[model samples]
Target: MAPYSVYVRAVRLALEEKGVAYRLDPVDVFAKDGPPASLLERQPFGRIPAFEHDGFRLYEAGAIERYVDEAFPGPALQPSAPRERARVNQLTSILDSYAYRTLVWDIYVERVSVPKQGRAPDEARIQTALPKAQLCLRAINDLMDDGPYLAGAALTLADLHAAPMFAYFTLAPEAEALLAEQPAIKAWWASMSRRPAVQATAYPA
Candidate 1:
């Protein structure tokens, strides 16, 4: 898995947070011809972060993260309380279903990555994504209400799940205004960004 992949970084953050030792075998899913055959062999669907542990194999970022948290002997990444655990799951689902596409692809990729790759950004796409992005942020912020973290009194998979996306999304200039509108999320990022796991898994420049 590449360090630049948000999904890969999410998994890595979980490993780092769990203090688990593991190897990250590189896979370029963005190869010119398409994803490498080796990746397809493990992931089947050509995702970047197919995982293996103790002879067990898994695909999909959420599944991998939960496995890492449960399989390892470390601080729990999931809350034990039913309501709190549900909140973690709910936030992760929102991030995966809505925020990932809007914040990462539509806004961050269009506004930041496109120019870096020597192509013009799709201004129309970014404009259209802004309201959607705001809705995602506000939804998350409302859920967070009076939090130092996303899922409540302690850090959980929810924070790890969202941090990687925020790491890329905040780089776009549009993020300044969009985040300013959601102070709870902005504050959450300010704290989450400083975690050792988050800093360690930072995208390479």
Candidate 2:
């Protein structure tokens, strides 16, 4: 699991939030030769953050987050009530299905990462993504009731799912204006960004 991957960081945040001790073995999926055979053995998709715990192996970030919360003995990362739990699941899904690609890959990668690599940003791509990114932010903001967190009063897997993406999305130049339109998410970031787990798993600057 690379420290820079949003999915990898999401899993790590769950572990940190749960007080679960673990080691991260780095896998470079973007290597010139393609993903290594060792990672392929653990995860056929060759994705970052293939996991193993007590001989039980897992791949997807969401599954691993739930596993860590259920298998560990720390503070609960999910709410017990069904409705709240549903909200957590909904928000997590939103981040995965909509927000991740629109905000992280479309905007962040084109606007920030590409520029860092000495490549000109794709202005047309960024322009096209702006509306979709705004929609994602609005959807998440609409789901919030009265909160310090995404799902509700308590911190849940939803926050962990989003924090990593937000970490990078905020670095994009377009983020300030988009986030300004969705104050709820912006405020959520202000608080979530300070958490020990988020700080611990932060992407390098």
Candidate 3:
């Protein structure tokens, strides 16, 4: 594993928490091309996790999450039904597209060795992402209202996406204050972080 991408780490933790037997296949994504040659065969885009088991191949985080949920006999990771499952998928999309992608970049923009940093990652960028993150929190709050889980009473892949990225966000100076503004989000973050699986994998070693 190239250390651990926040998303990858969350999925790994989800599997662990659910007690699903899984093997971590470390693909060298920084190699000459994207990932290793073997991985390329499974993932045309050469993503880090190209899941294969029982002679089936799967790619993308959502697909991988679904496969893990189905293949493993343990706590369900998604709600049953087209609509509820769609909601879960939608939450994943919002996290990947709207919240985490940009919010998680705050530190990188402020700290990394990029040629140029747009917006200075200053108050402006931070402020922009904060509301967007709150948007994610609101959706999560609504989804979670039905039960403890984002999809329902059971922990699902939606929580998997939310928890770890929140890890990155809290590392920022204003994270607590920013998240504190959203009561449901603050509570949910607290709940998810307290889970044993989440606690073990949240911080980097």
lDDT of 3 by residue, 1-205 (tens): 4435676776676687678777776777768755777877887876665667778877776667777777788887788889988888888888888776665775433433132534344656656666666676666677666566677766788888777777777666666766676666776778988888787675555
Error of 1 at 82 (Å): 1.3
lDDT preference between candidates 1 and 3, better one: 1
Candidate 1, residue 12: the lDDT equals 91
Cα deviation at 8, candidate 1, in Å, is 0.5
Candidate 1 clashes between residue pairs 3 or more apart in a chain or in different chains: none
Total clashes in model 1, counting residue pairs 3 or more apart in sequence or in different chains: 0
Instruction: Looking at model 3, report the run of 10 residues with the lowest lDDT sum.
Output: 106-115
Which pairs, if any, clash in model 3? none
If scored against the real structure, what TM-score would every candidate get? Answer: 0.98, 0.98, 0.79
Candidate 3 local lDDT, residue 110: 46
- Per-residue lDDT of candidate 2, residues 41-138 (tens digit): 99898888899998998999999999999989999999999999999999999999999999999999999999889999999999999999999989
- In order, candidate lDDTs are 0.93, 0.92, 0.70
Q: By the lDDT metric, which is better: model 2 or model 3?
A: 2
Report the alpha-carbon TM-score of model 1 versus the true structure.
0.98
| Cα lDDT tens digits for candidate 1, 73-179 | 99999998899899999999999999999999999999999999999999999999999999999899889857888987788999999999999999999999999
